[model samples]
Target: MNLNLPFSDNLPTNKLSASFANTSATYKFYWLIAIIEIVEKGQVNIKKREIFSRMISNSWYTVNYFHVSFGKQDLIQNAVEDILKFESLTKDIKKENLLSILENSKKIETKKLLEHFNLNVPHWFLSPWFPKLKDENNSNYKKRIYSYSQNFENCCLYGLYDENIIVNPIWIPYLKSNSKILKDFCYWNLSLFLQSRNPNVPDIPNKLIKPAIRNGLTKQTNEYWKNVFKELGYVECIFTGTKLLFEEKNFAIDHFIPHAFVSHDLIWNLIPIERSKNFSKSDNLPIFEKHFEKFYDLQKVAFEINKHHNSKSRYMDEYLSIFPNIDSFEKEKFSNTIQPLITIASNNGFLYMNE
Candidate 1:
């Protein structure tokens, strides 16, 4: 997962590599991403607060929705959680809307949160280029970095000011010309960093951004459940207890644990619920104590019926991965499998419906 930053005789390419070395928190990665994004937009004179806003916005979904751990040392995650609580925002807020809100926020607490990054992130991000400043104890240590940045011979990434950072004129062309490569490098490193912290989490790379579009469940999955309904004559929605009619297609298939949490549509996690209930249940965990038994019973009946009619059906294969033997599948085994996911999803801030 090397960065492979474009070689430049004029710029200190080695320092760019060193910038990402021995990182403790996720701030540097997100900070660099914010810089690259701003640079791409044809703006070199950027506000430090704007970079901070982009850092929070970029990691919003990773922390809030996917629940990716940015590790305990990371304050960015704390800032994100605080803003969400302070602003009373939904986890799924759009990036543009979230950024706009962050930029325009007047709350004193919100301003303080973004300002905290200025203490270390802006000065420390350029530490690799100015290693001498690492041990300096001067009250005006930031001023020294600012002085160095103004000298093009030093080739620092950006010139820091009291309120903003101006991209070094010498390095602007390099950043803009190689924007895509530089972005991929940052994300590649970020994915590796997150994977180490969240070893059990799946699809770490895809979780980095709020997906622009999520693919719908396959037709085969829908057809498989339709067969289950047809054989049973009717099925009750676990969430609302409404009887669903297959003849009228009066049901929608959904995840017992939210698809946003599981990030998959495997048949084992899928169940038919009242079509109308689906909208209300979007991305929320169903209270396990209230819904698990009914969900288990419905799944068992569906499995038994499906196994009898089409034992080799591809839809049944998903259950085999967890259940191992379809004939031996028991409620206890199913509970062992599903209960932790429910708990973890809840811990990750997926609210329970009606809670």
Candidate 2:
């Protein structure tokens, strides 16, 4: 049936999928994109969530029908918490002003207080009113429509980030039906590979391998990188249907973009593909289409493999392209580390990073 979402009027009909497939696929689309933003960009900025919530509210049926697997949710929650912990370990923000802000919370004038502290927020977020588009029926409201379009576009272009790896291929149909092609493309990003769940550990699946790579959790071990992958999921390698039984599972947790090219080893640029394929793929650009095409139909493959549209690499390219002459290595380093941490830290507002 019709998903009576807020943006339904703006979008076309026939995109609705009343089935459970559509709901789950939509959630996966949202969750995956959000996770990628967090891992790569440092955080999914809270202000952007207001806009996301609006879009989601507009499409309630598509959202409610699909239930995210409990295992996926738990893993995501843990990852976010760990990153927040890392932020706390590195920086300190005093609670006095934060407490004062909470105590003096008034509904109307909080905007001024936020600005006084130099807090970055989108204008439309948390506000009661949303902008309306003008039809031929109303000439006076045209400017309002233009303003909303510009604001919404800006929010979408620069707002979201994250790197999530837990997805079931079963989501293919529902996403295909919605014709949210970009979302479908991202749902099974080839560059974002997953490990077979680990077998030795009961809760942890042996076959599963993490798609992203950063430094290990601690300074203690030599093989910390490998161990972290094992913990995350790296049970076996599936390369072009080669299920070869090796003496020891000779797999390497490689980056989607070779770390040699992109110094930052965040979640977006990682995957647990075969060591041989990783070697063959090397530092070259990610092969966006070939992997999943063999299994799914051509139409579904086309819908799911639009490289630049839904891919995080495209976002990174756009971000870097705007400031082409990034000469200062130190500035780059500081920007990389600080911006993401700050954005993530600000998420959930009062939930201290340490917690």
Candidate 3:
């Protein structure tokens, strides 16, 4: 890492400022947050190879993914399609040409926008910046980004691969400077960037997305669930073996299938429990066999209570979605309802425990 590059006196020009300047919004956003996460972990130098892999990896903590449904697909492919769709929909990008190529991008092999990120999009969209660029020669993209960061004046990241990265001392402090007002500022932009479809324009500004920093996949809050759980006959903490009070904040909703595996919030996967047990289970899958019979009985009771009440029918709706084939709630076996969901959860990487 080159530690001694002289800092520039001027703030970044409009062309090189905060949003990375006409760069692919989808690509830039992921690159930005990945860098933010890496820096936050106290590592300044980065290997270029790590960037792509990190983009696709899942975190155990629930990501308040913007465009939650689209966000859940094969992560990398989704990002690539987002990049292509962004360019086509951007008014300033080779708008006509990109739209024309977008049709080609949907064909058999290219249907998923099906080529390596570096080799396909630029040339396909007639990208003025990267036409003819291939992954082997992809250093141009990184170098250009480094130049933009240098001009942006925050001086957060600088350096080429191999010799090592020279992270600016000001990097973290500058981005984190006013964090209280703009928490996870970069991460929100990444979500906006990823979620953006037909950009109202090709170059959406970073300022526009900053306000969404406080948003995410907020699930049912304890207060609402507390009321619902009482009706579900779950008036106690299953883990702590203590009675629950509606006014207390100690209650939590547990995902019978670990979220790392299922990444779902349907009422079917959730149950009320003590907060402490949730912490202990963390992202691990539970041994449902131990508690299945009791839970099945309780859920049926809860379903019947809510079935005739349309407003509360969500409880029934979610129950039915999980056990669609079973006509009689009383006759439904624990294995019948759970087996299918567990199969899906396992394929997505959930593990099972015999106990």
Best by lDDT: 1
Tens-place lDDT digits, model 1, residues 1-355: 3567789877788998889999888999899889999999999999999999999999999998888888777989999999999999998999999999999899999999999999889888887888778677755667787778767436788888889999888888998899899888888888998888877666788888888987776574456876777787899988787889877877788898888778887888988888889988888888888899999988888888778889888877888767877776688879988998888777766788973
Ranking by TM-score: 1, 3, 2
For all predicted structures, in order, the TM-scores are: 0.89, 0.18, 0.40
Best by TM-score: 1
Q: Compose the digit string of candidate 3's lDDT tens values, residues 45-93.
A: 6643344434432210122221122234444546434543443443123
Ranking by lDDT: 1, 3, 2
Say which prediction, candidate 1 or candidate 3, comes out ahead on lDDT.
Answer: 1
Q: Candidate 3: minimum summed lDDT over ten consecutive residues — where?
A: 58-67
Model 2 per-residue lDDT tens digits across residues 1-355: 1223123333322222211132222233343343333334333233433223322322221111111122343322232233224333211222233223333435333323223221212221211122233232333343343344344442222221221112112322322343344433443331122212211111111112222344651221122233333343433333344432323445455554334323344432333455677667544443323432221232122222322234443323322432352221233443453334323322312121110
Whole-model Cα lDDT of every candidate shown, in order: 0.85, 0.31, 0.44
Runs in model 1 lying further than 4 Å from the true structure:
1-6, 218-221, 307-313, 325-333
